[model samples]
Target chain A: MVEVQALSKSYVGRTVLDGVSLSAPQGAIFGVIGPRGAGKTTLLKILATLVAPTAGDAFVAGASVVSEPLRVRRQVGYLPNDFGVYPDQTCAEYVEFFAACYGVPARERAALAADLLQLVDLYHRKDTPADRLTPAMRYRLGIARVLAHDPRVLLLDELTAGLDPRARVEARELLKELSSMGKTILLTAPNLAEVQDLCTHAAILHAGQITQAGPFDEVLATTPPYRTIAVKFLGDVRLAMNLIKAANGVVDVQPFNEPASPSDALAGVTLLKELRVTFDGAYADASVLLRSLMHSGVQVVSFAEEN
Target chain B: MRAPHLKLPALELSPIFAKEMAGRMRSARAYMVLTVYLAIVSGLSVLLYMVSFLGSPRTVSGSGAVGTVVFYFLVGMQVLLASFVAPAFTAGAISLERENKTFDVLRVTLLTPAQIVWAKLISALGFTLLLLFATLPLFSLAFLLGGVEPRELIIALCVVFASALMYALLALYISARSRTTVGATLSTYAIVLGVVIGIPLAALIGSSTVSLALAPTSGSSSPLADLFDTLLTLAISLSPISAIAASQRFFSATGELWTFTPSFTGSGLALTLPSPFLILTGVYLIASVILYMLTVRRVARIEQQ
Candidate 1:
C-alpha cells in the first residue's frame, strides 16, 4: 500500500536521503533499518507527507504524497519519533480530539476512542491525563490517537525506540495484530535485530542509501552462503585443518589466533592456535566434519560459529 | 470525462477549536489569569471611582463627567490589556504544536488550514471576550453613572473586539513563522510594541515636523499641510489607543456615538474620511484577514514541502 520512487532529500547543503526507493505491499509489516544519520526518519517523513523530497515522490494508498497530501493523510496515520502528549488532556479525550480532527462525528467519537484505547491496551488509563501515563503507555496512546481515524496505512518512525523489553514485545504484538487486520505498516528502526523477529520485509540503509532491501529471509540467505567455524585445537592442528579441507562442503580453512596473554607467554605455555573453516553446507555436513575431526584423534577444545 | 470534485463538510466548530477550548478551560492557569485580570480591572475601577467622585464633590454633577472619565479609563485599559493578553494567548499557538511535535499531526488531519487558523483565533478571542465580559459590572457602573450611553458602550465593545482580533492574528502569524514558542511570543510582543506605541509616536513625530516646518508660512491651510495632516491622522488611527481617544473626542464634541457626515467644513482628506473608530476597525479587520490568509498560506507551504 506504500511505494517510494528514487526519493532524495537534502537540507541546505547536506544530503540526508539519497535516491532511496522501497515499497510495502498491503498488510505487510515493512521496516527500514539504519543507524543514526542514515535518513531513515527523513524517508519516513516523506512517505508520511510531513516532509517533501527534493527529488522523486512517494505514494500511500494510491495517493501521491506531493500532489494529494490531504488524501494521503486521510489514508495514512503517522506517529513521529518524538510524538508527545498534550498536557491536561486525558487519554480518551486526546483520542476523541484526534477523531474529531479526522471529522469523526461527535456521537461516534466516544465509542471510537474507546475501541482504539482498547486496541492499544490503554483502556484502563482512559481517564488519566496523557502526561501522567508512563512513556510506554503514552507511546501506546499516541498509537491509539493515530488510529483514531481508522487509517489503512501506518507510517511510524522509531515505533519501538526507548521502550522496555516487555513494552517492546507488547508493541510488537499489537503491531502484529494490526497487520493481521490488514493495516499496512511501514516503520523505521535503528537496527535489523530490533525488527528482525517482527518484520516480514526490511530494508537496510547505510549512509543515505539502501544497502540491502528484500524479504527478511531472502536478504539474510543471500549473505554468501559462507559460515566461519572457529575451532580450538589442542594438538595436531595441521592434520585437523587438512581433514576439514577434504571434508564435504568444506570451502577453505585458515589458522586464526586470539592475541596471546603476556603471562601465558612468560609461563612457557603453548597456546592452541584457533582454526577457522569456511564451510558451505547444511547441519549434516557440519556434523560429518566434526565427526571426522574427532576420529582423526585431534583434540578439540572449542567449536563455535564465528559470527 | 472529467471527474467532479467533492468537498469535505466543514464542521461548525473545528476539532482543534474544541480541543483548544477544552484544554484551556481545564487548566488552572486560565482561571488564575482571569482572576488576576479581574482583580486588576476591579482595583482600577474602584480607585478611579473614589478619585473621581469622592475627591471632588463639586465635579459630581448630573452630567456624569466622573462616569465619562471612568468609562474612558476602563475602556482604554480593556483595549490595552486585550492587546497584551491576546498575543500572549495566541503567539505560542502554532509554535507550541511544533515544540510538542504535533504540527505534522495537525496538518494531516481533516482540519483545513483555514479551520486551524480560525480555531486558534476563536479560542484566544473567546478567552479574551470572557475576560471582557467579566468586567461587565464595571462597564455597567459607567452606564449607571450616566455619562456613558448604551450606544457608546456597544461601539467601544466592537472596537475592543476588533483590536483583540488584530493582535491575536498578529501573534498567530508570528507563531506560524517561528519554530519555538519563546521565539514566537517574543516576536509577537515586538510587533505589539510597534503597533501600540511605536506607530502612534511615529505619526506624531511626522505630523509635528510637517506642521512645524509649515508653521511659518501656511498655518494648517496649505494643500501640502492638509495632505500631511490627513495622512498622519489616518496613520495614528491605526493604533487602538489613538482610535479610542479619537472616538471619545468625537463623542464629547458632537454628543453622538457616530457621525457619518463631517461636523465641520475642511479642505483636508482627513476631514472627509470616516471616524477614527470606524477607520481603525476597518483597517484592523482588513489587516487581520490578510494576515490570516498569509498564515494559512505558510501552513500550506509547510504541508506541501
Candidate 2:
C-alpha cells in the first residue's frame, strides 16, 4: 500500500513535482502515465526514498518514506529505469551484494541469489558479468536485484521505456506474473498502448498533475463515447439528413458547408456536400445508420468514421 | 527491532567496508598504487640513511634517530597515499551510488545516515590501512638501526592513525557533497591537501623568519621569546617530520620520558615542536569530525525532504 499527500519537489527556481497526491491499495497494479518532464521519475524517486521532496509526505507499506525510510525501503523494492550494475560483478555476485546490503545473511545469500536469478530468467547468466548482458538482460537483472529481499511493494520507474518490442513484451509478461502473486506494483511509463491492455489501473499525468486516473476503460468511458461518421450524399441532402436522424444511433448531425459558395449551389446540391453524423455504441452504428439512410431514398456516396 | 541473523554487530558498516575493499583489491590500479608507495618509503629510507651515514659519527643519532626517519617517510607517504586513495575511495563511496542510480536503494535500506557515513569511512580507511600494513616491513627496516625511542614510535603511530582517520572522514564529506566521483575526488584532494600541507608550511616559514630576525639576541628568554618557544614546540608535534626530529634531538641528549611537558634544556635539544603538531592534529581531527557530521546531516536531509 502507498499514499502520497501534497508531495512537491523543486530544483533551484523550477518546480518539478507540484502537490501530487496518490494512493495504491494492496495488490493493486497502479500505473502512472505521463509525457516527458511530467515529474513521473521525480515522483517515483520520492516514493522510493532516493530523492527527498521539498514539501509534503508519503508512506509506503505502512512506513513513512520521509521519516522511516529504512523501514519503507525494507518493505518496498524499487527498480529504477537507469539503475546500473558494476561491470566486473557477475549477475549472482551483483544480486548477492544487494542482498547483503539489504541485510540478507551471508548463509542465505547464495541460494537467494540463485532463486532471484531464476525468477528473472537470468539463472543461466548467474555467473556472467552484469555489464556483458544485453539491455533486456540488464533490466531483468535489475528486477532480480529488487526482488532479492522479497519486498512487499514494487516501484518500477519506466519498466519498459527503452526496450525493443520483444523485450518490452517480456517485461510486461514478467510484471503480470509478479502481480499474480499479489505484489503491489506501481509502475510509470509513457506508452499507453503497451500498458493499456496490461495495467488494471492507470493514472494519466499531464503537466505534473494527475489529470485523470482509474481503470483505463472507466476513464475512457467518462469521455464522450461517440462514433463520428462522414457521409457524402449522392442524392438530395435534406432528404438524407432526415433519414439519418431517424436511425438507432443517429445522435447528432452537422452539414458540410463550403466556403464562398453561392446560396443556390449550397442549397439542393447533394452531390458534394458531406453530412457528418454521430452514433453511440460500436462503429457498426455509423455503418448501420448510413445503410438505412441509403435504403430509404437517399443515394449514399461515401462514408467513413472520424479516425 | 532486530535484523535477523546479523552476526556482525556492525553489520551496517560491514557490507560497505567489504565492498570497498573488494573493489580496490580487484583493481590492478590499486596494486600499482601500493607498489609505488612501497617503493617511495623504501627508497626514501635508503636515501635518508645514506645522507645520515655521510654526516660523521654524529650520524648515529641513536635509536630515536631511526624512529625519526621512519616516521618522516611515513608522514610523506601517508599524505601522498591519502591524496591518491582517499579521493578514489571516498569519492565513489557515496557519489557512485548516484552514478549507479543505487543511491536510492542504499538510502532506503534499514541503515541510518550515521550508519551510512560510518560505513563509508570504514570502507575508505580500512582499505588504505591495509596497504599501509603491507609496507610495514619496509617501515621496520628503519627501526632496525635501533635508535628509535618507544615513545617516539607511539607518537608516530598515533599521528598517522589520527591523520588517516581524519583524511578518510574529510574525503567522505566531499564525496557526500558532490554527485559525481570526479568532482568529489578533486575537491577532496584539494581541500585535504590544503589543510594538511598549508598549515605546516605557514608555521615553518613564519617561525624561520622570526628565528632569523632574532638571531642577534643573547641567551636570556624575553617574554616574547618564551611565547615563540611555546608556539614552535606546538608546531613541531603538529608536523610529522619536525616532531620526529625534535623527539630525536631530545632523546639523543636526555633519556627522559616524552610527555606534553617540557624540559627547557636547550643544551640537549635545540627546540620542542611536538606539542604544536599535536595541536594541529587536534584541530584537523575536530574539523574532520565536524565535516563528517555535516555530510551525514546532508544525506539525512536529502532523504527527509
Candidate 3:
C-alpha cells in the first residue's frame, strides 16, 4: 500500500534519487536491491517521511508524504540502517517508550511491549539494558520497537546488512511471516541474492534510478537468459564431462578443479572434480538433464544453479 | 439551535518526557549532583551562621543581620548553581539524538515537533526544579532566624527558577540548531556567559558614558537621559544576579511588591517601571516562549539536513 511517483531528491547540485517510482502492494514484501550509495536508503527514507523529496511526492497507506507527513508518519514505521539505543533503558522500556509515543494507552503499554518483544524473539531479554544486547539482538529490538505502534507499512533500510547467516535467514523468515500477516514491507539490500527468495516484488536501484522493478521472477526474466549450472562429482571426471556436454540445452562446458570440502573429505570421499556448464532451459528440462546424468552412472557430488 | 459541541484536547504526558525523566532520575549522576549540591549549600550555611552570629556577641539585631546574610548567601548560591547546571542538562537534548541517529526514528513517530521540544524542556526543567527545591530546608534556616520574609524568599526562588528556565531553553534551542552535542554545549555556555557577564558590563560602561555626556544638562530633563535610565533598568533585569540584587534593593526601599519610577528630574516625564523581579520574570517568560517556538521549528526542519 505504498506509491512513489517520480520521486526525486537532491542535495546541492548532486542528485541522490532521481525520478524513482515504484508501488508496493498490501501484504507484499517489496525489496529495493542495490550496491552501496545507490540511493536505496534515500528512497526508503522518503517513504518513511523522514526526508522530503526534492521533487514529486510519495504516498504511504494513502497519505501523501509531502502534504500530510504527520498522517503518513502515523501509518508508517521506519527502521533506519544504523541506529543507537538508549543505553539506560531496558528492552521492554524502550519498546514501551515508543508505544507511548504512538499514543498507546498507558495501561496497555506493558502488555503490548511484551507481545512485541515475544514476536521479535526478544522476550527473554526484556529486562536487559538495550545497549548491552548483541548487535543481532539490538536489531531485533529495533524491529520490535517499530512494531510497537502496529503501523500498516514498514520501511526497513538494509534489513540484513550486518546479520550473520543464521540471523539473516531468521530475518527473512520474519519478513515472510510479517507479509503473511498482511503488513506491507519495503526493505533494502545490497544485493539481489539477499532478498531474492523472500521478496514477492523487487526493484533494482542503481545510481539514483530504478533499472528494473516488478514481480521478482519478472525482474529476473529481464536479465540475460543464460544460466550456469555447477556440477561436482567423485568418479570418472571424463565420463561426467562427456555426459554434461551431451545433455540437452547445454551450450558450453568447462572443467574446473578444487579441493574437496571438509564435509566431503570427512565423509571419506576424495578426488572430486567440478564442472561449470552453461545451460538454457526450463525447470523441467533441467530436472530431466539431471536424471539422465544420474542414469548414466556418474557419481554426482552436488548439482546446483549459480546465480 | 444548540451550539456546536466544543471538544478540548485531552492532556497526555509526553513519552519523551516520561522516558527522559525515568532515565535521568534513575542514573547515579542525578543523585550525585543532588548530594553534592546539598552538601555544599549545607556546609556554606553552617559556615556563614558561625561567622556571622557565633563569632561575636549574640543579640536580636545581630541575629537578624546573620539571618539576612545567610539568606542572601543561599539564594546567591542557588542562582549560581542553576546557571552552571541548567545548560548542562539540556545542551544535549536534541543534538545527542542526532549523534545517536535516533532523531529520524523519533520524528517518524506520531509525536509532533512541539511535543518533542516541550517534553525535553519540561523534563530538564523538572530536574532543575528538584535541585532548587532540595535546598528548601537551608532557606528555612534564614526564615527561622526571623530576618527573611516569606514573600522575599518566594520571589528570590522565582528569580532563580526563571533564570534556570531561560538557561535551559537557550541550551535546547542551541541543541536543536547544532549538529553535535559538544558544539551545542560549548555554544550554549558561551552565550550564557555573555548574557551573565557581558550585559551588565556593557550596561555599566553605557550608563557611565551617558552620565558624562549629560553632565552639562544634569539639572534639565533630557529624553536621552530618561531613555538611558530605562535601558539601564532593562540591562540590569536581564542578568539574574543583578536582578536579584535589584529586587532586594527594591523590597528594602519600598516594602512593596511593585512600584513605578519617579523622574530623576521632577520636571521630566515620570517613567513607570515594574520591580526588577517582575521585569526579569516577564522577560524570561516571553523569551522562553520565543525560544521554544524556534526550537520546534528547528526540529521540524531536521529532515532537510
Candidate 4:
C-alpha cells in the first residue's frame, strides 16, 4: 500500500508539487497522468524516498518515507524512466548484483536472478552484456533488476514512455502480471487512454495539483455530461440539420469539417455533409433522436459519438 | 524444516563494489593505465640510473649514492603519478551514475548511503592499490642496487598510500556534490593543485619570511628561533611533498624529523614529535574520514524534480 499526505515540493522560487494526496490499495495498479512538467516524476521520487518533500510525508508498506527510508526502500522497488545498466556485465550478473545489495543471500541470488529474468522473458539472453541489449530489452532488464528483492510496492516513472507501440503493449502486459501477483504499483504516463486501459485507480495532475482522482469508474462517470454526435447525410445538410435540431433532446446543431466526416471515401455517397448535434440527456435520448431522424426520411450515412 | 542457514553480515562488500569491480577490471582502461604508469616509471628510472652511473666516480660507494638518487626519484615519480591518477579514478565515480541516470535507482535500493560511498571509495582505492602494487617490483629492483632501507621503502609506500586515500576522498566528495562528470573531473584536478602545489608554496613563502625576520637576531639564542623552525616543520609536515622529503631525511640519518642545532647557543630544538611522516599521514587520514562522512550525508540529499 502507498499513501501520500499533503505532499509539496519546491525548488528555488518555483513550485513543483503542491498539496498532492492520493492512496493506492494493495494489488491495485494506480496511475498518474499529466502533461509535461506536471510534477509526476517528482511525486514518484518522493514516494521512492529518493527525494524529501518540502512539506508532508509519504508511506510505503506501512513505513514512513521520511522517518524510515531504509525500511521504505526495502519494501519499495523504484524504476526511474531512464535507469541505466552497467556496461560489460551480463544481465544475470547485473540482477544478481542488485540482489546482493538488497541482502539476498549468495545461495539464493542466482535462482532469484534467473527467476526475474524468466519473468521478464529475458532468461534466454541472460548471458548477453547489458549494454548490448536493445532499448526494449534493456527496459525489461531494468524491470528485472528492480524486482530482485521482491518489494511489496513498485514505483514506476513512465515505464512506457519513449517505447514503440508493440513494446508499450508488452510492457502493459507485464505490468498486469505484476499487478496480479499482489504488488501495489504506482506508474505515470502522458497518455490518458493507456492509463484508463491499465489502471484500476488513477489521479490526474495538472500544473502540480491533483485536479481529479478516484477509482477509474468513478472518475470516468464524473466526466462532463455534454455529448456531441456526428452524422453524415447524403442529401441537403441544411435540411438534415434542421430536422435534427427540431428532434427531441437536441440542444444545438453545427456543421463539422468535411474531411473529418466518414462519408468521404464511401462510393455513391454524393452530397455527403456532416452535422454535429449536442445532447444534454442520457444515451436513451440520443438513441430516440437518431430514430426520429430516420423516420423523417433523412438518410444518415454514419453516426457516432464525436468526443 | 528450514534449510541449513548461513547468514552473512549486512555490511560486507556492497554490490556496488562488486559491480564496479567487474566492469572496471574488465575494461581496457585499467590495463592501459597500468602499462602507462609502469612505462613512465621504467623510463624515468633508467634515465636517472644512467645519469648517476655516468656522472659519478666509479667506485663501490658510488653505487650507494646512485641507489639513493634512484630511490628518491622513483618515490617522487610514483607520488606524482598516484596523485594524478587517484582523482581521475574517483572524481567520476558518482557523477557518472548521475550522467547515466542510474543514481535514482541506486538511492532507492536497500543499501544505505554509507554503503554506496564506501563501495565507491574502496573500489577506487583498490584500483589505486593495484597501481601502487604494480611498482613493487620496480621498487625492489632499486633496493637490490643498495642504500635504500626496508624501513624507508615501507614509509614511502605508506606516504603514497595515504596521499592516494586523501585524493580519492576529495574527488569523491566533489563527485557526490557535482551534477556532471566533466564538472567533477575538472574540480578534482583544481583542488589537487591547491593541495599539492598551492598549499606547500604558500607555506614555504610564509616560513621563509619568519626565518628572514629572525636572521637579524645577531648570534643570540631566543625562543623565537624555535618558533620559526616549528612553523617551517608544521607547514612541510602537512603536505605530501614535504612528508616524502621528511622520509628522505629519516633515511639520510639527519636529526629525526626537522630537529636542528641552533647556530648561536649550540642548543637543539625538535619541531615535531614522533615523526613528520606520522603527523602528515595522521592529518590526511583523519581528514579523509571526515570527508567520507560528509559525502554520505551529501549523497543522501536528493535534489531533482
Candidate 5:
C-alpha cells in the first residue's frame, strides 16, 4: 500500500506539487493523467524517494520516504519517464548490477536477472548494450530493472509515451498482467483515450493539482455532464446541419471532416456531423431526436458514441 | 521460507568501483603510467651503472659506499613514480562517475555515502598498485648490483607505498568535491606540483634573509640552506615524492638514516639526519582520510528531482 499525505514540492521558488494527497491500495492500478508540466513527475519522484517533498509525507509499504528512504526504496520501484539506463552495460550485465545493488545474494543474481529479462521479453536482447536497444525495448528493460528487486509498489511515469501504437498496446497488456499479480501500480500518462481504456482508477491532474479522481466510472460521472455522438448523413452538410439545428435533443452540432458532404462522393448523399448533447443521464432525449430526424426522411447512414 | 525482505546493507554494495577499476586497468592510460614508471626506474639504473662503471669508486670519508651513486638512483625512481603516477591514478576517480551520469545509480542504491567514497578511493588506486607490484621482478633485480641493501630496498618500497596512499587520498578527495574529471585532474596536478616544486623553491629563496636576520655572526651558507631545506623538505616529503628525496638517505654504515657533516673550520662537523619522510607521509595520510570521509558525507545526501 502507498499513501501520499498532502505532498508538496517546489524547485527554486515555483511550487510543483501543491498539497496533494492520494492513496493506492494493494493490487490496484491507479493512473494519473495530466497535460505537460502538471507535476506528475515530481509527485512520482517524491514517492520513489528520489526527491524530498517541500512539505508532506509519502509512505510506501508503510516506510516513510523522508525518514527511511532505504526501506522505502526497497518496497517501491520507480520507472522515470526518460528511463535512464547506463549506456555501456549490456541488458544482462545491467540487471546483474542492480540485483547486486539490491543485495540479492550472489548465487541468486543470475536466476533473478534471467527471470526479469524473460518478464520484459528482452531475453533475446540480453546481450545487447543499453544504448543500442530500441526505445520500446529500452522501456521494457526499464520495467525489468525495476522489478529485479520484486518491489510491492511501482511508480511508473509515462511508460507508454514515445512508444509506437503496437508497442503501447503490448505494454498495456503487460501492465494489466503485473497489476493482477497483486502489485499496486501508480501509472501516469498523457493519452486520455489510453487512460480511459486502461485505468481501473484514474485522477486528472491540472496545473499541479488533481482536478478529478476516483474509479473511471466515478470520475466520469463527477466530471461536467457532456455527451458526444457521431452521425453520418446521406446528404450535403447543409441538410445535416439544418436537421441537427432543428433536433430536440442535440445542444451543439459540428461537421465531421470525413466523407466530405459533396454530391460526387455520395451514394445518394454523403455528410457527417458530430453532436454534443447536454443531458444528465437521459437516453430518451437522444432517442427521441433520432426518431424525429428519421421521420423527416433524412436518412441517417450511421451513428456512434464518442468522447 | 524467505530469508529476508530488503536486507541489502548499505556497506556491502560495490557501487561502480570494481567496474571502474577493471575498465581503467585495461585502458592505455594505465599502461602509460606503468611504462613511465618502469622507464624512469630502468633508465636511472642504467645511467648510474654507466657513471659508476666509468668513474672512480667514491667514499663519504671512512664510511664506504654510504653515499654511492647507485643508492641515489634507486631512491630517485621511488620518489619520481610516487609524485608522477599517484595523482594520475586518483584525480578522475569520482568525477568520472559524475561525467558518466552513473553517480546517481550508485547514490540511490542501499550503499551509504561513506561506503561509496571508500569503495571509490580503494578501487581507483588498487589496480595501479597491482600493476606496480607486477614490476617487483624489475625492482628486485636491482638488488643484484650489490651496492643496494635489503633494508634500503624495504624502506624505499615503504616510502613509495606510503606516498602512493597519500597521493591517492588527496586526488580522490579532489575528485569527490569537483563536478568534473578535468577539474579534479587539474586541481590535483596543481596541488601536487605545488607541494613538489613550490615549497622547496620558496623556502630556499626565503631562507637566506631569514638566516641573516636570525644570526648575523654566522656567514655559514649550509646553516641557512640546510635549516630551510629540511623544513621545506618536510612539507615536500608529505607528498608521495618525499619518497624520492628520502630514497637518497639509504642505510649508513651505522644503520642510521643520517648523513655525515661537512667539516666546518676548526670544529668537527655534526652528522645531519634526513627529516623522517614517514612522519610527513603520515600527516598526508591522515589529511587524505579526513577529506575522503567529508566526500562520503556529501555524496550520501545528494538528491535530484
Candidate 6:
C-alpha cells in the first residue's frame, strides 16, 4: 500500500533523508525505527504529501506523492507527531470538521463523528472541549481525527512518543485493531522494541539511510545472532569473569569496574562491578547460564539481554 | 480513445471557513466585541447628533447640516474602526495556524491553497462586514434627518467595506509571510499606518513643494508638473481618509458620486482627475486581487520551505 523509492529531502544544504527506500504490503503494520533526528519524521512527512522530497518520490495507495498529491492525500490519513487542537472546539466538532474538510457530506458528519469518537474510545467525552482533554486523550482524539476520512493508509509519526506505559499498550492494541481492519499503517518509533511486538514489517532507519528492512524475522535474521547480556554485581570481579568465561555458549566477557568512591571506602564495601557477556545460545541455555551464576554465590544485581 | 470526462468542481463553502466561523461565533468574545462596537457607534452617533442640534432652536432647514455632519462623522468612525478591527482578526490568521501547528494538517487535507486563503479572507471579512453593517440603523437615522443622499450613504459604505477588505488582505499577506502572530500583526499595523497616515503626509509635503515650485512659473504648463499632479491624485486616492475627503470634495463640486471623465484646469497644470472614490475603488479592487493571488502562492509554497 505504500512504496518509497530513493526519496531524499534536504533543508538548505543539510540532507535529512538521503536516498531512502522502503515498501509495505497492503494491510501491513510497518514500523520505521530510528533515534531522534534520524530523519524518521521527514520520511513520514514526504509520504504524507506535506513535504516534497528533493529527489525521487513516494507513493501511497498507488498514487504518486509528487505527481498526484491530491489523490495521494485522499488515500492517506496522516497524524503528525505534534498537532494542536482548536481552542473552543469539542472533540466531536473537531472530528466533524475534519470530516467536512475531507468532503464528507453534512448530513453524514454527525454519525461519522460519533462512530469515530467511539472507535477511539472518546465517545463519552465527545462534547468536551478538545483542548481540555488529557494528553493521552488528545492523542487518541488525533487518531480519531485522522480516521475521519477512513483512508486506506495511515501515516502516524511517533504515535506513542510521550504516552504512559498503559497508554502505549493501548495504542499498540489500537494499531493492531486498525491493522486487522485491513488498513495499511506506517508508524515511526525511536526504538525497535517499542514496535517489535506490533509491527509485521519493520525498517531500521539511521543517519538518513535504511539499515534494515523487511518482515520482522527477516530483518532480525540479517543481523548477527548474538545477544549481549549485562550483569551488574557487587562481588569478586575476577571470579565472576572466570566463571562466565567458562560457561557454555559464552563467547566473550568484558568487565567494567565502577569507580571506587570515598563513601564506598568509608563503608568498607567492595566496589560494584558490571560485565557485558556476548552469548551465542538459545533462550533456554541463557536461562541455565543465569541459574548457574546464581548458584555460584555471585551477587547479581541485574541480568538481562541487551538487543 | 475518447477524452475523459472532465467537470469543474462545484462551488461550496470551504470547510476551513465553516470551521473558523463556527469557532469565532461560538466564542463569548465575539459577541462581546459586537456589543462593544455597536455601543460605541451608537453613543458616538447620539453625541454627534446632540452636539449638532442641542442648545439651539429647532429649525426645519438646519436638520440637513446636522445630518451631514453626523453622517460624515459616523462614516469616518466606521473606517477607523475597520482599520483597527480587520487587522486584529486577520493579522494572525495564517501565523496562528503555524503557531498552533495546524497548518500542515490543513495542507494535508483536500483543501487547496486557494480554498484555504479564500476561506480565511472571507471569514475575517464576514465578521468585519457584520460590524460595518451593524451601524446601518444609525446610517438610516442620518438619512431620515434629511441631508444625506442615498448615493452618498451607499458610496460611503462601499468605501468602508473596501477599506476593510484592503486592511484584512494586507494583514493576511503579512500573516502568510510572517512566522509569528505578533510579528505579523505589528508589521501589518506599521504598513497600514504608513499607507493611511504616511501617504497623506507625503502627499502634503509633495503638494506644498509643487506649489512653491510653481509659484514662480505659475503661467506655463509642464509635463513634470502634470506628472506630479497625477501622482499626488493617485497617492491621495490610495489612502481611505483622503479618499473620503476627495469624495466629499468631488460631490460638493460636481454633485455626482461617480465619474469616468478626467478634467483638467490651469492650462493643464491643475488636474481635476476622475472621481477619487472611483479611483480608490478601482485601485483597491485590483490591488486586492493581486494580494490575494500572492497570498495564495505564498501559502502554496510553504511546504517547500
Highest-lDDT candidate: 3
lDDT of 4 by residue, A47-126 (tens): 88878889989988889988988888778888888778877689999888877877777788888888899999999999
Per-model TM values vs. the true structure? 0.80, 0.76, 0.82, 0.80, 0.73, 0.83
Ranking by TM-score: 6, 3, 4, 1, 2, 5
lDDT of 1 by residue, B194-236 (tens): 9888988888888778788877664645666766666676777
Q: Score residue B240 of candidate 2 by CA lDDT.
A: 47
Cα lDDT tens digits, model 3, B1-305, are 11112221248778898899999989899999899989988999999999988764587777878899999999888888678788888999999998988888998888889989999998998998898889988887888886778888766877888889888999999999899999999999888888777777888898888787886654565766877777788778888888878778778777876654745554556667888888888999899889989999988884664
What is candidate 2's fraction of native contacts? 0.45
Say which prediction, candidate 1 or candidate 6, comes out ahead on lDDT. 6
Candidate 5 second chain TM = 0.74
Residues B1-305 of candidate 6 have per-residue lDDT tens digits of 11112222357577888888988998898899999988988998889899888743587668888888888988888888777788789999999999998888888888889988999999999898888888878887788788778888766766777888888998999999999999999998998898888888999998888867975565564666666666787779888888888777778777877752343444543335567777777788787888999999999883664
lDDT of 5 by residue, A1-307 (tens): 8888888887887888888887778888888766457888888878877778888998889999889998988887778776466665789878877777777776777778788888889999998987799778888888887787788888898768677657888888888888887789998865345566677787877667878877877876676554566676565566666766666645445443433346645644433443333322367767776776677776776666666
Question: TM-score: which candidate is best?
Answer: 6
Global lDDT of each model? 0.80, 0.72, 0.83, 0.79, 0.68, 0.82
Q: How does candidate 3 fare on TM-score?
A: 0.82
Q: Please give the lDDT score at residue A201 for candidate 3.
A: 93
Evaluated on chain A only, model 6 obtains a TM-score of 0.74
The superposed Cα distance between candidate 5 and the true structure at residue A92, in angstroms, equals: 1.0
Worst 10 residues of 2 chain B by lDDT: B1-10
Off by over 4 Å in 6: A223-307, B1-12, B55-61, B209-213, B216-230, B260-272
Off by over 4 Å in 4: A224-307, B1-8, B202-226, B250-274
Worst 10 residues of 1 chain A by lDDT: A219-228
For model 2, the superposed segments whose C-alpha errors exceed 4 Å read: A10-14, A53-56, A223-307, B1-13, B47-51, B54-71, B74-84, B211-221, B232-274, B303-305
Residue-by-residue lDDT tens digits, candidate 1, A1-307: 8888899888888888899899889999998876567888888878777788889888888899889988987888889878777886899999888888877777777888888888898899899989898778988998888887778899888877667657889999989998998889999876555576789888877788987888977755653345768888778777887888788876556565544578868864456767767666788998888888888898777777765
